[model samples]
Target: RRKAGWVKERLDWFEQMSQLAVDREYVSGETFLYLGRQYRLKIVYGSKRSPVKLRGKFFEVNLSQSMPEQDRREAVRRAMWRWYRAHAWEKIRKIVEHYSARLGIEPPEFRIKYQAKRWGSCSQGSVLNINLRIIMAPLSQIEYVVAHELCHLKYKDHSAAFWDLLRLVMPNYEVRKENLRRSGWQYLL
Candidate 1:
């Protein structure tokens, strides 16, 4: 009975994550998240070099007016990814610099990309792999993830020493970690 219950729970969790991943659409007034804040998407029909820009509280997606709705949707998705990736790189780099200085180590090499299951990881070679989706999370949560990975530079494993280093660098990391755990699904684009 316990095994059946565990399987049912796992299936339910997968269904929820899948639903969130596939139900996203690029319609105007549809809301998106960034830095733990919600911003509405505004579809504007016009020609521009860049397809998307965030203005005030809305993400303006500029497209050719005559473009078909299906094509426009795909364009919006691509444009959003471009915008998010650029911003994520900028923000994560700065954060990494700030934490690395505090940790008294030269900033390690890093990459921002899509990772289906990890927020961030540190390799044996000390390269940091940060998920681009983390841009949608709050700045504090982003800091926690970066700090956690950076701690791996000092202690390769999540032993007590590694966690101690993380805590020393980020005193309130536990709260940020909990927030990410509870609401991370909503950050998916």
Candidate 2:
């Protein structure tokens, strides 16, 4: 009976420890997986480690030196966002210019941001806002997004005419749209 009680106590302690491990929030010096990369968190200032790495199936992030967990996460996110913004802008600009000239339309001013729920949006004044996260998406999908917003310049609503305009630019817009919807979460991460 005593042995049984001791075993139960040990099991309870083990369960508690497991729960703690599962519940612990972000911590410096801990390793975690993101985007199929394994990142080691280091808490040293002026360290030479890059913020993120694209391993075979995961992404690794190196915590900023002497940074708090939340701050470190924010820093990593900012770095990723910056990189995406530059790449996406370059790609989108080329596409926009190509299509704009072909359609004989004035190009809208473009802006990139970290939007939570929108891939892109166009204003009444013809300014286009694209999510920076779109950079991480496939190139074809990004092109589709740009074309979709450009269509709005002619047809502001999602009417059939808007879709027709989109089709004029991207015959496979639907397929690209579906692809973006399916893999959009990858960018958010």
Candidate 3:
């Protein structure tokens, strides 16, 4: 009975993952997030290699009409990755600089990471790793994560002092933490 239950649970988890993958399939007019704002995709068939740009309220995708449907999807995916990576690099660096001096800790070596369990982590070597998906989050939430990880530089563990430091840096950190936990499901894609 225990073995059967375990197998059933595994199957259910796989099914949910598959469903989420399908749901994330990109299509024209579908909304995608950036800095907590949703921009609807506008596919405009065109001739350039550069295919994605944020124009006003729309994330316009310029593509070649001759491209196959499958190829177009792949192009969009690649374009999105490029967009996220470029923005994340700039945003994360600025946040680290802003908080490092305020917290009285030298800024750690920050880099983008694709970790499954954490939005950010601080290493013993003073290196900070931020999950790239966080680029999609609101600026406040991104600051909260950066503050929380920087706090770890002073306090290695999630001790009371760590929370105190986090609170000092971000007064409403608890709210951001809670919101981050709830919205994390969306980043699985």
Candidate 4:
């Protein structure tokens, strides 16, 4: 009765949310984002070397013929991650250094961490973690997040000193922050 009804309602909601899960499928022709731009995906069986690379606006995946279908999908997933991590590391590192130097703040120990809701976070030990998925957003937005966490190294809370420092670093940060919040869900995939 009551318990059965509650179970049924919860299952219904779970089913709905599962449909939007990004890793559920590896179908060809799906689109992916990089630096705020959408690239149409094309998966084709090929020999070796590059598994995924962007040509113009298309995300072309060349799967090794020897790999099984499931392996091919995993390779595509791994390849995309490698690409994102490389780009994110290069760009975010520079942004952190730039902001830290300007504020006379030592660069906090930084690393990339996957997170659901946050783009960046600064822990008590001055460790700054940036979400790797953030690389898929616009560079300005990425810089906004970098400035934010770096500011946290100075002022741990979202206080006036923090806001003033962030504003000084990124004049257009408010716009970038809003954009990241409004559209970040698309990049979660």
The candidates, ranked best first by lDDT, are 1, 3, 4, 2
Best candidate according to lDDT = 1
Candidate 2 vs. true structure, TM-score? 0.64
In angstroms, the error of model 4 at 143 is 0.6
Error of 1 at 50 (Å): 3.4
- Give per-residue CA lDDT, model 4, range 1-189, as digits (tens): 869987996787566656556463555778788889988877878647577778888877888777886677777877778878887899898988898998898877899978887898988888999999999898888988999998888889999888998899888889998887666767755
Residues 1-189, model 1: lDDT tens digits = 869987996787778777787767888998899999999999888757568888899999899988886798888889999999999999999999999998999999999999988999998789999999999999999999999999999999989999888999999889999898867888887
Better of 1 and 4 by lDDT: 1
Q: What is the C-alpha lDDT of each candidate?
A: 0.90, 0.70, 0.82, 0.82
Q: Would you list the clashing residue pairs of candidate 3?
A: none
Residue pairs in collision within model 1: none
Evaluate model 2: give its lDDT.
0.70
Choose 1 or 3, whichever is better by TM-score. 1
Q: Residue 47 in model 4: shift from native, Å?
A: 3.5
User: Judged by TM-score, which candidate is best?
Assistant: 1
lDDT tens readout by residue for model 3, 1-189: 769987996787667656666545566888788888888888888657467788898888888888898788778877777778888899999999899988987778998977867899988788999999898888988999898899988999989988998888889999999888666656643
Judged by lDDT against the true structure, how good is candidate 4? 0.82
